[model samples]
Target: MIWHLIAAVFAGLGAAGVGLLLRLVSGKRLPRWIVPVCAGLGMLAYQINHEYSWFDHKQTQLPDSARVVDVEKGQAFWRPWTYAFPMTTAFSVVDQDDLITGQADGQRLVQYRRYRFRKEYVDQVTHQAYLMNCTSRETVPLAGEPPRPRTEATQTFTETDPLFQVVCQQE
Candidate 1:
C-alpha cells in the first residue's frame, strides 16, 4: 500500500512538472492552478489503473496448477472520492493436488473458495467437503434409491436450485 502511494506521488510530481514547463513555454499565459490540477489527475489515474489491474496482477503470481473455480463482483464507497464504486472482477482458485488426492477410500474431500475485492481489502471464503470413505464399511448412496448404511440421501426435485445441487452431491 505504501508502494502504491509513493508511485502515485511520483506520477503526480511528474505531471506537475510537465504543466509547469508548458506554462513557462507559453509565456505564462496558463493559469497557475493548472499545475496542481494536472498533478491531481495524474494521481487519480494511477490509482484507478492500480485498482482495475489488481486481479490480473495477482493471477499472474499464482502457480500454473491453480484452478479458478468461481468469480463475483463487489461494490463499495470511496469516501475520499465521494463516489459509489463497482468492482466487477474477482477470482477463486483451488489447488489441483487437493482435489485429485482427496478422493480415496470411497471418500471424497473437496476444497472450494471464493474471493471478493473491496477498496480497502480482499475477502476470502473457503469450505471443505468430507464424504463417506468408500473403502470403509459404508454403502454408497444410489440415485433415487433409499438411504443406505453410513450414507445420507436426499431427493432432487425438478425445481431444485443448481447451486445447491452442485455442492450437495456426493462424489
Candidate 2:
C-alpha cells in the first residue's frame, strides 16, 4: 500500500513536470491551471493502471500450480468508463496441486481449496476449502465441522465446468 502511494505521488510529479515544461516552452502563454490538471490526470492514470493490472498482480501472488477457473467482469455506475466497457472485477481460481479425488461409500468425492479475488475499494482475497460430492453436486465447508450434505443447483461438477476439468483432466 505504501509503495502504491509512493508510485502515485511520483506519477503525479512526473506529469506535473510535463506541464511545467509546457509552461516553460509556451513562455507563460499556457494558463496556470494546466499544471494542476496535468498532475491530476497523472495521478488518475496511475490509479487506472493499478486497477486494471489487479488480475495480473493477483495471478503473480498465486502458486505455480494454481489455475484460474473463471473470471467475472462488471461495470460500476460511479465509473462511467466501465459502463461502455466492463472490467474484470472478480475471479475464482482452484489450485490443481491441492485437489484430492477419491471415493467414499461408493460416492465420488473431491477436496480442494477455492481462491476468490475481488478488486474494489480495498482489494480482497479469500480461500476456502470444500469437500464436494461429485455424484450429487453437494458441497460442505471443511472448517472443523461435520460434513453436511447440501445440494447446490448452480454449482455443476460436470466435465464442462472448469473445476471438474482441472481435477478430472489430471487423471
Candidate 3:
C-alpha cells in the first residue's frame, strides 16, 4: 500500500514536471493552473491503471500450477465508463496441483479449493472448498460449516453456473 502511494506521488510529480516544461517552452503563456491540473490527472491515471491491472497483477503472483477458470465483469453507475464496456473486477481460479480426484459410491468425486478475487474499496480474497461429483456436475460447499450426514448422500446441481464447469473440467 505504501509503495502504491509512493508511486502515485511520483507520477504526479513527473506530470507536474511536464507541465513546467510546457510552460517554459511556451514562454510562460500557459495558464498557472496547468501544473496542478496535470498533476491531478497523473495521479488519477495511476490509480485507474492500478485498479484495472489488479487481475493481471494477481495472476502474475500466482503459482504456476494455478489456473484461472473464470472472470466476472461489471459496470457501476458511479463510473460511467464501465456502462459502455464492462470491466473485469473479479475472477475465480483453481490450483490444479492441489486437486484430489477419486471414485466413491459409483460417482467421480473431486475435492479442491476455489479462490475468488474481488476488487473494491479494499481488495478481497475468498477461499472455498468443495466436494463435487464430476459425473453429475453436483456441488456441495465445504467452506466454514461442517458437512451434514445427508449432504453427502444427496447431490444438488445448479444449472448454468460456471463453477461447475471449472470444477468438473479438472482431470
Candidate 4:
C-alpha cells in the first residue's frame, strides 16, 4: 500500500513537471490550474493501471499446481469506463494436486480446495474445502467436522462450469 502511495506521488510530480514544461513552452499562456489538473490525471491513471493489472498480477503469484477455475469481471458506477471494459474483480482456483478421489455409493466423489481471490483496498484470499460428485455434478462444502452433506447448501454444476470440468475430467 505504501508503495502505491509513493508511486502515485511520483506520477503526480512527473505530470506536474510536464504541465510546467507546457506552461513554459507556451510562455505562461496555459492557465495556472493546468498543473493541478495534470497531477490529478496522473494519479488517476496510475490507479487505473493498478486496478486493471490486478488479475494478471494475482495469477502470476499462484502456485504452479493451481488451475484457474473461474473468473468474474465487474463494473462499478464509480468507474464508468468499466461499463465498456469490465475489470476482473474476483476469481476462483482449484489445485489439482490436492484432489482426493474415491467411490461413494457408485458415485465418483472428489475432494479438493477452492481458493477465491478478491481485489478490494487490498487483495484478499479465502479458501474452502469441497466434496464434489463427478457423476452427478453436485458440490457441497465440507464445512463441519464430520463433513456431512446438507441438501440446502449443495450446488449443482452444469457441463460448462469450469470447476466441474477441471476436477471431473481427472481420473
Residue lDDT tens for model 2, 42-71:
999998888778888888988999999889
True-vs-predicted CA distance for residue 14, candidate 3, Å? 0.5
lDDT of 1: 0.55
Between candidates 2 and 4, the lDDT winner: 4
TM-score of 3: 0.83
Which candidate has the highest TM-score of all? 4
Per-model TM-score versus the true fold: 0.59, 0.83, 0.83, 0.91
Candidate with the larger lDDT of 1 and 3? 3
Tell me each candidate's RMSD, in Å, in order. Answer: 8.8, 2.5, 3.2, 1.6
Q: Which stretches of candidate 3 lie over 4 Å from their true place?
A: 143-166
lDDT tens string, model 1, 1-171?
678889999999998998899899999999999899989988988888887677677678667755554555565465233245655356556544343225655555333322333234543444433232322322223232332233454223332433223333434
Clashing pairs in 4: none
Separately for all candidates shown, the number of backbone clashes (residues 3 or more apart, or on different chains) is: 4, 0, 0, 0
Off by over 4 Å in 4: none
Pick by TM-score: 1 or 4, better one: 4
Indicate the TM-score of model 1. Answer: 0.59
Provide the global lDDT of candidate 2 against the true structure.
0.82
C-alpha lDDT score of every prediction, in listed order: 0.55, 0.82, 0.82, 0.92
Provide the lowest-lDDT 10-residue window in model 2.
Answer: 147-156
